[model samples]
Target chain A: MSNPKEHLYQKTAFDLVSGFKNKQWKAAEIAESFLNRALDTNKKLNSFICIPHESILDHATLLDEKRNSNEDLGSLACSPIAIKDILCTSGISTTCGSKILQNFTPYYDATVVEKLKDKDALIFGKTNLDEFAMGSSNENSFFGPVRNPWNLDCVAGGSSGGSAAAVAGQQCAASLGSDTGGSIRLPASFCGVVGVKPSYGRVSRFGLIAFASSLDQVGVFTKDVRDSALLLRIISGQDSKDSTSSSNFVPHFLDSLSIKKKWRIGLPKEYFQQGLDSEVRQALSQSISLLGKNKFEIEEVSLPHSDLSIAAYYLIATGEASSNLSRFDGVRYGYRASNPKNLNDLYKRTRSDGFGYEVKRRIMLGTFALSSGYYDAYYKKASQVRTLIIQDFQKAFEKVDLLLTPTAPFTAFKIGEKTKDPIQMYLTDIYTTAVNLAGLPALSMPCGFDSKKLPIGLQLIAPRFEEERMFQMAHYLEKEFHVQNSKHHIVL
Target chain B: MKFDIQTVERIAELSRLEFDAQEKEILLQDLSKILHYVEKLEAVDVEKIQPTYNIIESECFFREDQISVHLSNDSLFKNAPEVQEHFVQVPQMIASHE
Candidate 1:
């Protein structure tokens, strides 16, 4: 057991694939090891929503047979990865952490899933998330909140909370997650791992269950930056299924890490504001100083519209969410109430019973914003302001190549702490929501720890198609900050 | 930004969501607070600003409408509670104007 654990855990996907190709270790052995580890961790932390053990084993056996016969293997061959429940996995129940689609199994694989298949990647399981990817903490999940491996009492920041927790807990090498308003980075921050939300459309959103169509993006969480680069390399591409996906040539993300120069990393003043925990503030300052010591020039900048991001995101995301979610009218696919005599009752009962409270709240708010007389007053006004927010980033990027901030206002709070108050929960995204709203690339890497020993992340944001800058800077900071030491470790 | 029960009811209808009286009361307060905060957008001077819709650059992307042999009918209706004639069945949509 320990031998398989040593062979599987702490190894990057690329490394595992290489080992499988060289016949150093059988893919079946690696797959069984990861499965056992995942099951063991589930007893400690409920990170998985669905585990495709039998299927994964079957896939691994085939890969092993091919490898033994000296057949060609793709980049992610036999690599163990977890899919966030938001991404549709054909034949697997993709709940989106909501009761409405609780038993729903997508008929076709999402474009990302197809890409992973092309790479011969073994999807280990589907991790939990906030219902419809709505909340900042995993507590909103209908499957129940995923506990942080660091401290079971604390939350794994959501809606990608489960993905982050799984990686932090060493359940899987890497996991794919969706970020609408900092879902991926927040949990990565809380779990003390590395997660990146690519520039909008960098990764196709074809099969990702829409949270906020404009805001939602698929990202990856990994224990190391190299693995994230590898996973993103395979996943990011243009697809006809997603109209928003970019046709621009995808960059060699792995090559981006090798470029070494004295880069200018920005320190945004707006992020270091009131309500930010003092320890987190100090940790970010110290991390900035460390970066400066490493010859990376740290410039202080300002984004005045940063504070208004949460409000704007809520309005815009909910407005779009209200529209996208209208498809689940107890009519087509998904859970329908027992029996409805009329169309109104059908729509009403299915929605009321299917959606969780937070989801309903956002939908109602979104619906109100786009209502007949209120469209111009709310949704239209928000669109205009959103342009201004984008302009703020455009102007700021003119002065600095990349901006930095604390991933969240504080470290992981106790589970159920903010579920009672929706506003307080929304506040958790104060540092992260803006980057999503602006549709820029951002990466959260472990920077330091708070007094209570929870990990704090230093978020790095770069311009559109400038993911290389983020990767290089993050790699530099990873070495400079030394975030992967035993201190960041969690033993399940 | 001031919201009342009457406004909440209307908003719920527009959103096509079903909220009971208790949920409506709670939402009235929450929605009022959110509206008040978002009302700051009105403070910004946008005399000639055009409302932006789509952000990503590029347009006119069209896909050939070829029917690809994808998931089987059984798999498609696996999660549906009601199905008929290889299609999902639901109550007839009574159009608002109907």
Candidate 2:
């Protein structure tokens, strides 16, 4: 028989919920198994910045008591979910992998965190991330980079790398991550897990520390599409706290999973051009042929403005980042510089000492972009170009139901591989950023593993608030690909 | 698109950040490279397209201005670096003339 510990950790969140409800396993046993796994693998993966070991067990034990008393249980009764460090967790430090907020703890929980608690999901831990969610690789984190579980030397894609790695490493049943300019999807692609970035206002951003307001979104990283659907339903809805949140009807995502339809999948000709790794390209083509044989129409579509996405994304993301991050001045909370001669000295010294290199670089870029003379040329021009990119997606979707592309140009690269050159690192998000620009819903799931045994992710982009379609297609393709059966060759 | 030391310094001042000489040199190179790349946006034909300042098309949501329970002072100051009686402490804003 398979090891009981291994079997417990391997079960998906859906399986865990059903098994716990049926008394197959106690909630404490499930929590202990995953928590121990997280603690055991954290040394190798560095996925969690803070794993509140005792509190998680206490919460799990409370669930067991409720079940024993014949009390009604929440939908996610005994599920263990890891949260990205960017979200505020009451009494737990929400570091965002930066020294700026190292000792800071919020008095209130983020809207998503509160929702998860209401559903009785164990708040497993706070996962690591790029400092202020700035970098394409987790190397920019102050806590050090999160190593990819598949290959220890390769960097887990970021700034949600820790959340992705935690799910892939079996450290948590699911995780919550924020995506601004491909943070969630790129790491999910690299780590071979399901990463979903809902449309701009699909989820509330109230307690999520802002990176770039227009593009920032709270999303999920899960082992399977069903778990993604389940978690997405629980955390999504209109919230009074976040004005940008949509009032659109939040559907029952889990109930719609079995609905099948042949979606017209578009392959953007520009995304298929040079720079895509041959192995990833081959894997995508194979997946395409499989879909084509299964009656899904595949066609070549043009997103003419794709080449300009990166330029526009950087100008806009950094410009907003500069303004949003201005809150970190030596003030009421967070790190403060020592021995300041005056208020201005304190502001400058505290920020300089607190922020990591990438955060400072982006701040400079944003300050320059929004400066008096250059605003029209840089930020305004990029915003206008963003309109064209949005229009490009609008026109493409008029002909196709969904778009398919390689999530990243290549798989996870070695740590320190592209850190020396900021531009080289920024180019990694070439295929994933435009989706954010248009505020569309997209997901990344494993298609195949490269020859090196590293996971290759295929991204599916659907129109705004049409996540249900993306889920149906991804779930269908996931079964066809037998993604669940694929073994993770984790180093630890 | 290239940034000189003086320009980097000006931007850093605006951003309230300080960098030593070597750090400034590196920032100058990195910012120059990134800005040069983004300069390509000038070539895109966007004269007709309106800027998308806000991607969310939702209307502004307003709520009642009613009194409600909020975080107490103790909880609000829980994360403050330095706190005095019901207030956050910081460096002296006004310098005394010597």
Candidate 3:
């Protein structure tokens, strides 16, 4: 019998699925092992807000029965995956990390959840997130901040902080996260994992609690690139429930990963500006050099409007957030205030009591930006600037096959450092937010570590429908950077 | 224009939120700074530019809407704070004209 601890805890999704296929481990044994490890680690990491103990074991027994009979199985048959609370799971509490929806149990699974279950993946528990996916740090979560696995003093990036921390700390094989701005990539970077934010429309947003409807995209956090690609292939596709979902055929991302890289990659000058820490910049430069030696050409490109991305992102994101959140009126669903005398009172008291401070702040800013007299002056004009930012990426893509940038300006800071200053918190997304505005696909891979041994991510971005090219480059860099097995390499 | 106390209160009311006296004072100052920065937008010439919303521009793609089984009324009201006759109860809408 295998020493089931590490195998159960931190095995990559790819390895686990392959093992399950060969009947090397029974599904029940695998599920129990992970559940045990998750329960043990969650105490320190606070990565999981809910763990579906009884249901997961029940599902495992069924999968083990199917395996013993030699029945054909789905892709993720018996593999464990955690979901950020933002995605609704049928019969499970889908809080979106807000008190407003604390008691709300979704009657239907989101399209993504339905697909995951159809593939036979175990629905692990819901993870914590910023209330409504608003904050860059997980501290804004109503359940309490999720601690970074790499260092307990630091924070796991948010609003997908719980998912990233869970995956990083061996709580799950893979976890799904939503990235409206940098929620997915930021946490993935800080937690030292592979995160891919698929192109807008790649994944269905049918039941995800909306943050910025246009910008919000669901992504995955995995211990390895191949696992990320596998999860991406499964979750992506058009859906009738989501209008923005692309009708295009879902690419065979696993097959795409096999394609060799023989193209030019651009490093944006604006991303490597003065504020970037020298160590992080060096890590990116070294990665570029490694790629150069491997026959991939690298060049310096300019995205002049890049500096305005943070401002424009905040305006556009908050403006849409304001509009999307208006549905929580304490009338149709979710929380209702205690003895609300009137409709307006119900709306006010419910929202005031349900939402957290950061959520309230964004809603206010968004409402102000989109208000009648200021619409043209703020929202519309910010959109034009957003267009300019998109053009910057478009113009650069013409000259290079892909664009490269640091995933974040600096490495993850200590918890409570940025809590007081909201602007500084927003600034953490400086590099990752631009891609959301442009509707492009991007991935954040671990590039280097800072002086304190925290991970820094180098972002790889590609043009529309060019995720294949982006993956090819990422695979090459994964080898070139020599970052493999450097952090959290499970030897079991 | 910079937002005064009255403007702030009005916007707060419009947003269905409450702002205390100190918060209103702070909001006034913050709004002034933001408005000053956002004033750059006025210089842009958008006379002929139509506002662009929904960049993807997809038509509604519905499922086979042949009564594809709706949620049970019990499940719908399971989390409701107030329910009456299998329907969610809310405060009556008091019309201004009425």
Q: Pick the winner on TM-score between candidates 2 and 3.
A: 2
Candidate order, DockQ descending: 2, 1, 3
* Per-residue error (Å), model 2, residue A193: 0.5
Instruction: Rank candidates by TM-score, best first.
Output: 2, 1, 3
Show the lowest summed lDDT stretch of 10 residues, model 2 chain A: A483-492
Best by DockQ: 2
Per-residue lDDT tens digits of candidate 3, residues A116-206? Answer: 9999888889998988999998999888889988788888998899999888888889999999999999999888888989899999998
Query: By summed lDDT, which 10 consecutive residues of candidate 1 chain A come out lowest?
Result: A1-10
Error (Å) of candidate 1 at residue A427 is: 1.1
Candidate number that wins on DockQ, 2 or 3:
2
Whichever of 1 and 3 has more DockQ, that candidate is 1
Tell me the whole-model lDDT of each prediction, alpha carbons only.
0.86, 0.92, 0.84
Error of 3 at B21 (Å): 2.9
Proportion of the native interface contacts kept in model 1: 0.63
A260 Cα displacement, candidate 2 (Å): 3.1
Better of 1 and 2 by lDDT: 2
lDDT of 2 by residue, A1-492 (tens): 335556577778998998899999999899988988999999999999999999998998899999999999888888889999999999999988999999889988999999999998989989999999998889988898999999989999999999999999999999999999999999999999999999999999989999999999999999999999999999999888999999988888899987467889999999999999999999999999999898888999999999999999999999999999999986888999999888899899999999999999999999999999999999999999999999999999999999999999999999999999988999999999999999999999999998889999999999999999999999988998894336646657
TM-score of each candidate structure, all chains considered together: 0.96, 0.98, 0.95
Q: In model 2, which runs have C-alpha deviations exceeding 4 angstroms?
A: A1-6, A483-488, B66-69
Compared with the true structure, what per-residue lDDT tens digits does model 1 show for residues A1-492?
A: 225546475677878888888778898888987888899889668899999889999999999888878888889998888999999988888999999998788887888988998888998899999999998989999999999988999999999999999999888889999998999999999999999999998999989989788888999999888888888878998888889999878888887787567777778888987898998898888887877776777788888878778888889999999999998887777889987877888888899899998899989888888888888888888787788888889988998888988999899999988877777889899888888878899999888888777899889999988898789888877886773345655767
